[model samples]
Target chain A: MDWTKEPEESKVYPATHHFRVIGDETFDAQTLHEICKEYDLRAPVEAGNASSGGKYRSYQVSVHFPDRATHHRFHNAVKAAKGVKVVL
Target chain B: MRIAIGCALAMLALAGCVTAHIDYPLNDVKPQGRPGVAVSLELKDERYSDKHSVATFAHKTGTYNQGVEFSRNLRDYAEVFGGAGTAESWYIAPDRLYWKPSGPMEDLRDRLAEHLKRAGVLKDAFRAGMRDPAGDGGVQNPETRGVQNRGSGATLRVALKRFVALKARRPGVDTFGFFGVSAVARSREIVAVKAEWTLLDPAGRTLDNGIVEFVEDGDGSCWRAKNKPFVLNNRAARRLGDELVKALRP
Candidate 1:
């Protein structure tokens, strides 16, 4: 879920937030890293589980998000990457 | 992405040619008479009805009428199809360079439907199709055949009897050969469109039934995108639309 809908007090500025991303094989660690680096979030985006069909890969990351703006931008960027089906 | 673009262009194409109506029953018999003043319309495109004609799409690539007989590229069937013969070295499918409408007549049909609507003619449209969750559109299929009308107006069903096109090979391109020695002399395009419309009263008896026909023979430069033929193709559809308006409203 995006922070835009969440209560501001719950965000606790300068916090570490976890993001779960699902996409095709192209949305691997390196591909996600490009955006994390640009947004200045924690690096080494980790590859996680494969969907039941194995057609898609899941990625997990818990990084420092300075504010909702950065988190939103990072989410949008990930969503736009090649083969990326979703970003949460 | 291509579907999105086609939808966008479909919106634009419909904005123009704001005049017409469309077809049903895959009619071979002549239409008897005109339907009453249409307050609303339902449109159907029957391009997929004829097995001999194949609609073109970017991702699907253009395949000859018979699938097993030809490769997706120019090399395989060029040898046999009387349309165009290509040199053995030509490897790319011409579709790689030119884009064709998945169904041009369908696009034209939408344009006509839009015109009818603006004239205070119809209610909402039954879009072509959609994905799983709430799939509701006039997608041609066995189940779709049974889709009932909104019970407010007449129905228009359009069918393509025949369409064929041949474009001249590009300049400095000797790898592709045409059936004729001169590419310009060989370029050809044809379109045949038929629409049968039916209006039924609330009691389910036929109010009116009619047919509109549009046909053309022309030529294009090498690709579906390039020249004359595509323009001629659009013009031919307009001519057909004009006839429907005349027959339906006169």
Candidate 2:
């Protein structure tokens, strides 16, 4: 809608639901945090730790969304970003 | 600027390429038999590595390590549960963990179902709130009533731990020391393992208990890895679940 000559506007969705990501070293905490900040979502890694192995560190990441649509967009975008393994 | 843009695009491409394998329930089927069998599933917190600091004359050294130990105990538990045929019904919460299955659970459940089905046992697994007496012994039904009152389908809890150690020995020459020879030798070893599990009955009663112990000798490896009690915990649960189902068959 701006002077950049963009056509139709894309849909902006509300967030709901939560997702867990089990990844290798391909993606680090910093990279994931940046992505979460960009999408207005909470990474909530500490919470995941409580649920998973406490001191036995695994590359587990959990993120909360407002809805399915928002989750879908973010899921796709994150999976496509850099390093990620199993995401649920 | 162009290089930065290219890097961003590459990163995006990578994220999209990741894949996950999962299964979702497609249809509901009625399970045969009386409801007295209990299926237990449990998840436990992971143990961290031991840390110790040594102070020697104004100098200190610290050692740290971390990782999870995988276990295959779940399979054993499943074997015990699947012994009953259509005469008894097994109960467990039908979650993604139940249906889709993960590494150990997936293998354990699939194998149990296959064996149970072949043995002419295995009726149906039910979810909470959904009543189906004819399906897996309804609430009002005697069998179902007993199970409901008894509290069927719960996870068994367990705790596991691990450790590493070293040893020393006399050299072969030491054996000949009596013959005027002497020798000494030092060896490095890694010993690791820790685990414990608690069994629960259908009525949410703490029925029996089991323990898992593992010891592995390391060969001078800086990093030692072991998966015992974690695996054993699953086995214990399966065993307890199967036995409970068999014993409670009405």
Candidate 3:
């Protein structure tokens, strides 16, 4: 939590970008898993953690992009992928 | 004499007419509905020179909890979709107040751009000439939709801040004047952190503001082997974010 507590000499790793994508509740978890596999990222399923009050459980992805430029590229590609309703 | 008397009476009547009156009941006005859902996110302030341990504890608790929530829920989903390396970038100078590196900030900004672009609210998100020219173009990630024109021309820019617990209270014997307590209660330490966000429109108009607070009660028993407080906080945040996004759906 206190990231700053770490020393300055501590090497900062290559930035890992975050994306929040919204989609239909009915979308299959397995399919999402497959898509991640194709993209070379890991997909972890956490169904119970989402708010039950909302009809659908939201999914989150943390894709590794070498840099900002690559992150943009990845974002564009995901946007074009099938079954995505929206991304945030 | 008659004219003078009449004038005096008239003056008294005029004075009475203009006199202020105290109304017992107040006017009734209809309240408007809050149309949409409001969501807020904030980065904890990390001033290096914090003198108090309480402040430091509050900041760390908030950030850790938020990260866990985001990772467990959103990161999990993203990973399932092949985006496994999603995590927050943080620097804990514990000594410095604000030292978030540019790389992390840019990473977050890019992600936000990607989300907005997909939502079709990119253009209006920032005011005229205030928009990030670089981000105006589409994001480069694989899991997003290109910039679509969401023509409402209404968008929001959010300035985020971490939340801290200032006070807490429990109802005592006295109904109206009950004994109050602080967030940091003794024998059972309670810590709280807040995520404060402020939203503004593209035309430089301020629109909305909100705060999300995370509270944790100390574990005295150690019998149950409580889950790491940071991890629980993170998990909760993912739930909170998902709910927030749903509420903000345009």
Report the backbone clash tally of model 1.
5
TM-score top scorer:
3
**Best candidate, DockQ-wise?**
3
Better of 1 and 3 by TM-score: 3
Misplaced by over 4 Å in model 1 are A1-11, A40-43, B1-250
What is each candidate's DockQ, to 2 decimals?
0.01, 0.01, 0.04
Residues B1-250, candidate 2: write the lDDT tens digits.
3224222322321111111111101111113322211212332111111210000000001011000000122222323222211112222212111111111111222233333334322222111122233332221233212111110011111110000000001111101000000000101332222222222222223333322222222234322212111121222223333333332223
Q: Once superposed on the true structure, which residue ranges of model 2 sit more than 4 Å away at CA?
A: A1-16, A47-64, B1-250
lDDT of 1 by residue, B1-250 (tens): 4224322322322211111111111111112211111111111112222101111111011122211111232221111121121132122331121111121121222222233234221221111111212121112223223322211001121112110000111122111110100001111343333343433222223334344433333334323533211122333333433444444441
Worst 10 residues of 3 chain A by lDDT: A3-12
Candidate 3 lDDT over B113-136, as tens digits, reads 333334333232211121122231
User: If both were scored by DockQ, which would come out higher, candidate 2 or candidate 3?
Assistant: 3
- The model with the greater TM-score, 1 or 2, is 2
TM-score of chain A of each: 0.74, 0.51, 0.51
Cα lDDT of model 2 by residue, A1-88, tens digit: 1212211212112322233443344556566566677555444543232112221112333354544455556666656655543333
